[model samples]
Target: MAPPAQSPESDLTLPIRPGDKPPVPLPTRPTMIRGFTLACPVCGTRGLFRRWVNMVERCPTCHLRFERIEGHWLGSLSINTVVSAVTLLALVTVAMVVTHADPPIPLLLGVCSAVAVVLPVLLFPFTRTIWSAVDLLSRPLAPGEVDPRYDPQELAALAAERAERDRAGDGSGSGLSDPGPRTRRSDEPRPPRSSRPHDR
Candidate 1:
């Protein structure tokens, strides 16, 4: 028989354990807005970077590690490149349209060069957060990725959600399908007989 279909929220529901960190609830618009504003994508805390090029190791508020995995910043670099290219293309198009037949080649080159250099620098920080948000959205938080102390409000909301799911007859109170009881199969491997003689 085919497995039962699960709701979208049910997919996001993680199994709660005693020492496990709570799952970070990612609301799309709000998370993206926070990223655009150059704040912590997971927690919305500001001033994450001390320098324009240097971001802190982790978020102070939620302790979210910015670089979730190795080479994570590569996504941010790609985002920066794409944004810079788009900005340059738009500016060049506008300049060409305005100048028409009397386009000043030297002036256009100078402006483009400046934009190429500056826009990436200006967008660097924002791109990092944006990419982080995008990554988080694409790949939901794994265990131990964020800080242990989850936000009180978020925890409360999650608890309420679980309660509702339980009341709705989801079977498993954890919002997942219960396998019922375990039954060992005949084909399953059995422990080998002891070679040593039994002690008296």
Candidate 2:
């Protein structure tokens, strides 16, 4: 079947080419916080999920692809499992402490079973976002992974850094606002002098 016609804006939202850097640097604290809220870790733009179990393929604002790599969802599953297990453990511990004299075995079992069934589902979206943030931090963006046009701040920074380099005239300049392109060395290797030079 033929695909629907794409608008110019939609065309611009293409995934960054492999090995390309993301438009802006990923902030650790903010990303984690966003993940907890089930928002896009890169842009913090909300509305990623259409339903509790369904997540959009990419960030609506920044166009950052949620699944950055193959088998990325595995990380989310691991996170969900850990969180669910921990929650169950805490609940069991609290129940044991509260009803020390006669721990209701049947009730505890039922509660644990319910939690085992429900908690993972409830945490599904959250785990996905959290894993995205974690993976982003662990595996830095590659080239062409995310478009830079969406990030004005980083673009401005890059422009300023280039201007600084131009002003320095020796390819020596520091990134003013954020981590950016490496400064080129002032002393570049020159071609060897000709051995047969003579017309003096």
Candidate 3:
């Protein structure tokens, strides 16, 4: 299907390409906040999630490997837990403080229970994305970590990278530079001159 046309005035004119390298994430604060909006931290695009909590395996725009690895999202569990704990505590604290530290037990119980159930579920996607951003930033995607579809391109990029590294003396050893055009005499063992024929 054809994409919808964009007006020239639209932000579409902006340059936001992620480049060939693994995503260079924005600063830490912006990165984490991007998660709350369910934006792909790599490209700042909100098309990463298919549903509220249903994340696409890979980013549609930059093709970043979202999961990165199996069970990598376990970090989000910590994010959710911490956020949930803080939320529940904050709510409880406010209720008690408002009621002179003696808020009704039933009211507190009901409210906390409801908030606990709803907050986690509602924020699951956010925490997961947030965690993903943190993880991505901490472990900048290397060439080998890219999606399989990008292997050819990444391999080329990697080769270029290694070449540059070798040039810069970052590799184990530098490559020998070409010594100009080869002279046949210098390049090959001169065949024994046909001494007998030449003598004639």
**Model 1 lowest lDDT segment of ten:** 147-156
**lDDT (C-alpha, whole model) for all candidates:** 0.84, 0.82, 0.76
Candidate 1 on 129-194: residue-level lDDT in tens? 999889888876765566645543456567989999778765545666667998989999987987
Candidate 3: worst-modelled 10 consecutive residues by lDDT: 146-155
lDDT of 3 by residue, 72-183 (tens): 9889988888989999999988988899989999989999999889988888888877888888778766655555434444556688899897777854344676669966
lDDT of 3: 0.76
TM-score for every candidate vs. truth? Answer: 0.65, 0.65, 0.57
lDDT computed for candidate 1: 0.84
Question: What's the distance in Å from true for residue 180, model 3?
Answer: 31
User: How many clashes does the backbone of model 1 have?
Assistant: 0
- RMSD (Cα, Å) of model 2: 15.1
RMSD of every candidate to native, in Å, equals 21.4, 15.1, 15.9
Error in Å for residue 70 of model 1: 1.5
Rate residue 44 of model 2 by lDDT.
Answer: 83
Ranking by lDDT: 1, 2, 3
Per-residue error (Å), model 2, residue 64 = 1.7
